[model samples]
Target: MKTLPILLSCWLLLSSCGNNSQPAADTAATTTPDKPAPAKAASKPTILFFGNSITAGLGVDPEQAFPALVGQKIDSAGLGYMVVNAGLSGETTAGGRSRVGWVLRKPVAVFVLELGGNDGLRGLPLTDTRRNLQAIIDTVRQLSPQAKIVLAGMQIPPNLGADYAAQFKQLYGELAQKNKLTLIPFLLEGVGGVAKFNQRDGIHPTPEGHRLVARTVWAVLQPLLRQPMAQAQ
Candidate 1:
């Protein structure tokens, strides 16, 4: 213990001679911590177009699609918002249900629901179709409680049987009324039977057809837009 203390004293003496003292931090300074991600810009209110090929504007200029048209109108009106096209070609109501969450991550203020056309084309059962669509609406309302819903209806060709078509079209009305939402009676209003209005595939709409669909959808949309965000029921 005596030898250890002598060695420590010699080490201290050598250290002092070598001037190895620790430096003091400057106290007259301010520390600026990193800024928090700039708040992600608080994002402009978003419009989510969650539909299938029709909404995706397949086989047409992407910028000229109906959703794009709606966005253009909203922009021109200075709504201070952005639109998200979540449309996937060949999507069904069930598919919409499956991906609803991923789309909702955006700051969506309004939702344009246009699915089930493929389901109608594929001649899916009405019960299954209705269930899927209902699930999607329920999921979306849960995500954005105050978000407005504009459900677009699709019609099946007569060859598919009137019974099936009746059930299919009826589903939209029932769901819309039940959910307290606005309904665009038929998405393919003027384009369903007109070859000039649809593409060669006779499924997706032509550019002009899309414009018509936008006009039809907009009729329901116009009144909704008049409702202030705070007063929207």
Candidate 2:
């Protein structure tokens, strides 16, 4: 009984120790640092127009070239795409084949391939043309599987032997079929052989003829551009 006070003091001390030693639950709100809003995806699809002088806007005034006209159409139609012309004057499939590797480095959405005209003009071998064009398609596919390809077919001048001309014209169709690609049969269409449509040389097109070419290109391209997978991300 006399030690009762001592026991009570020990009990109090233990109670105080327990209170001090017990861990309190943390109630602080933990939140992820407010992340910056994700960047908006680019609205404009990028189309790489890879070809020869036709794409380069060569021989025509800058504004009157086929690529420029195509750009205007894209803008007017509100397709939300930009066209990049990598065309060079007097370029052949062999040259294009050599250059295409470097060309693939760009962020290309789709390729508007208008090669083979110079090849035919220079009387290059059919095998060389086929190899070069096929290589282009293959390279594009390898680099960008989602890329849509539109091959603009060019006919050999009839002055070339009939057999060779036939083979050259047939090549475009065959490539289109084999690769499941889109074809703009006879890129010049209404303008190729016409006097009013061509330049004085009768080989290249005049400004009016380029406009028609752009219109023809647009007719085929607009449909593909409308397709969902055809646009770049």
Candidate 3:
């Protein structure tokens, strides 16, 4: 994730796109001026994509975000699952930790945790980041014991210093191993630092970049999708 100002500016740019696809229902917070209505229970299982602006589709139409693209892939493949993009712009691990419980208010078949980029960007302490992430994981497990989780690993520029960068990169692998979770080693595998794949800001992905990201996420997500629901627990 980029700085707040950069993300806000990018959001403004993307939000101006007249044809932006509607965000997934689960992520949209709506209210009626009259008496509040009760939420209807979901008819289908949900694959919750939890993350920051990247997952929020910062510089592109909402439909172009990888999570929404993955949703399209699911529909094309005839998978009867709903995709919930719970991405909030400029979110850090601590922020995610605090909000995950509310986000998990419904049953989730799969939880895709894509966070920590902002923490890394802000040069937050590694220990605090790990702790907050672990707390989020623990909350998910506690709230939805049977839900399968996929962790999206992120990286920051080496300008932070090699040791710090290397440790940050390794942290995901260790967490995935310890938690026995499916891990996407690098969320930006083929697109990071690639001029053509990113927006002019060089942090967020472009429409094409989101497609590549969808493929990366799909590689791991597809298997989990194919697994029998009862067997995944």
Residue 12, candidate 1: how far off, in angstroms? 62
lDDT of 1 by residue, 37-120 (tens): 112112345567789999888998766678877766665666654556678888988888998876675335678899988898
Which RMSD values do the candidates have, in order?
20.1, 24.3, 8.7
For each candidate, what is the lDDT?
0.70, 0.72, 0.79
Question: After superposing candidate 3, which stretches have Cα over 4 Å from the reference?
Answer: 1-41
lDDT of 3 by residue, 1-233 (tens): 11111122222222333233332322222212232211221345668888999999998877778987898788778886767778899999999999998777665788999999999888899999999989999999999889999999999898889988999999999999999999999999999889999999999999999999999999999989999978554
Worst 10 residues of 1 by lDDT: 1-10
Q: Identify the superior model by TM-score, candidate 2 or candidate 3.
A: 3
Ranking by TM-score: 3, 1, 2
Q: Which scores higher on lDDT, 1 or 3?
A: 3
Ranking by lDDT: 3, 2, 1
- What C-alpha root-mean-square deviation, in Å, does candidate 1 show against the real structure? 20.1
Q: Please list all clashing residue pairs in model 1, or write none if there are none.
A: none
Best by lDDT: 3
